[model samples]
Target: MAGPPRPAQPRPVWFEAAADGTIQLFTPSDSVKLRRPRRDPRASIVVAAPPGERERRVSVTGQTTVEAEGARDLAERLAARYWDLDERADDLAAMVADELIRIVRHPERVRRFAF
Candidate 1:
């Protein structure tokens, strides 16, 4: 979710890019991140390589929408992708039990550089 525009308001979120080239993330329906985006559809995501890795960065700027569908599915998929859920399956179950909204970003521009 993207924070409101102001001093130091820009932030990063755990988002996944589907094969269709759209970004998706799940957040509680009441998240503060949903507040500003609902007011303004503009948003962006920036990704950088790990600290010890070579310098590579990707940035995407886009318009966003909050949707009611696919939050649980996305959450489940991401949990598995990023975690060894064999020992924490219940944690994922609990997370998906909440009222979530899927934040979708439709990219209008993308920038990438590696050095």
Candidate 2:
């Protein structure tokens, strides 16, 4: 496969799905998770709703592309979603500009389950 190999252990992450259905994820530029995708453009993402509810989840197997140019923009969106970035926009933007990496996954298959 041209994608990243399954990790020895699962690493949970926060992700956002766009209206177009592609998934967006942000991680540190030096993260192992980012390394795998850079080596191989394939990736899989699993997301669960209402945390701790395994039965309600969505899994996406796809191809990923590193989007360095848009990393700062994506980071800003993420910060707005997860934190109060209004007052600290400059700081947050600087941090993301320096260390963040954006991974955009184009879904090949999507599976959802409700149990």
Question: Which candidate tops TM-score?
Answer: 1
The CA lDDT of each predicted structure is 0.88, 0.78
Prediction-by-prediction clash tally: 0, 0
TM-score of each model, paired residue for residue = 0.90, 0.75
Q: How many angstroms is residue 53 displaced in model 1 relative to the true structure, after the best TM-score fit?
A: 0.2
Model 2 spans > 4 angstroms off: 1-9, 51-54, 86-94
Return the lDDT, model 2, position 69. Answer: 67
Tens-digit lDDT string for candidate 2 (52-78): 755688888989988866667777777
Residue 112, model 2, lDDT: 93
